[model samples]
Target: MDNVRTDKWLWAARFFKTRSLATDAVDTGRVKLDGDRIKPARAVKVGDKLAIDNGSDAWEVVVLGISDKRGAAPVARALYEETEASIVKRENDSQARKIYREPASTIKGRPTKRDRRQLGKAGE
Candidate 1:
């Protein structure tokens, strides 16, 4: 199709695992079309620009095709083209993330029962 619902396009393009997830992102202001925030049902046509923020990462893409059905990564990739600046920025962000790993990731399994007891006694 020449155009499709924003959420459907997002899902078909493999941006989100499901249409509902894409719709939720759109509703929450995480997705924008043509530089303006839009509803999930908004129509997206080829050449339209989109900005998507997915917590740890963001993307800026130009729509190249429209489809309602999800497909392989290579096929889905044809639906949109990422901008050069977006690619550079994403790479920089990824590098920064690697250099500054989350503190939570360093923590191993949950505290043992003995550890919990010690913590409770220490708090007294």
Candidate 2:
């Protein structure tokens, strides 16, 4: 196909795990076409530029191929070409995360009463 719906393309390209998730991302403005927020049904063609933020990572890519079918990772990867800047930024962000992680992320589930007491004492 010469063009495909943005959400379908995102799902086929493996940017999101499911088409529903891709649609949600587009609806929430986390997916943009040529820097403009676009509806999930918007059509995407080859050479179209897309900016996508899928929670854990952001991508700036140029469409290289179009397909509505979800395929293997290698095939999905061929659908779009990520910008060099996006790759470098993602690597830097990954390194920074490795060096310094959010302290709250270490907490497992709900804190126990004893843990709460310790936190209270620490606050004081």
Candidate 3:
């Protein structure tokens, strides 16, 4: 009988920085409740499963606690339990899908020993 709104809980649990952001994410089809679309004010209780797609990755977590007010990160950490699969997939997607720029290899073409010796005399 002591449940909170889905979006509000998401924000309280630190899934999103703000309640409005959580509501927007839910309204935009990025957040789901037990495989169904949910409104921002939908009541949520313990054990309810939520599937959220955060652009590059998706997550599935089971509700463990509920609150309407945002709290500290340490307190927020107790609100849900992210599935092992979600953690693995998210980490893999984050590592594999990222684009990295190596500063040492920024310039095009190969740098010869003479070029290496001069460091920046390529236009000569």
Which candidate tops TM-score? 2
* Cα lDDT tens digits for candidate 3, 1-124: 4768888898888878778888899999899988999898889989999998755468899988877778899888898899998899888877765565343454568867765766556435
Better of 1 and 2 by TM-score: 2
Instruction: Give candidate 1 misplaced runs (Cα > 4 Å).
Output: 106-124
* Off by more than 4 A, model 3: 99-124
Question: How many pairs of residues collide in each model?
Answer: 0, 0, 0
Clashing pairs in 3: none
The candidate maximizing lDDT is 2
Off by over 4 Å in 2: 108-124
What TM-score would each prediction reach against the true structure? 0.83, 0.89, 0.74
- lDDT for predicted candidate 1 compared with the true structure: 0.89
| Pairs clashing within candidate 2 | none
State the weakest 10-residue window (summed lDDT) of model 2: 99-108
lDDT of 1 by residue, 1-124 (tens): 6758999999999989889999999999999987789999989988999999866689999998889999999999998999999999999999998998764464468977776676678669
Question: Would you list the C-alpha lDDT of every candidate in the order shown?
Answer: 0.89, 0.93, 0.82
lDDT for 35 (candidate 1) = 76
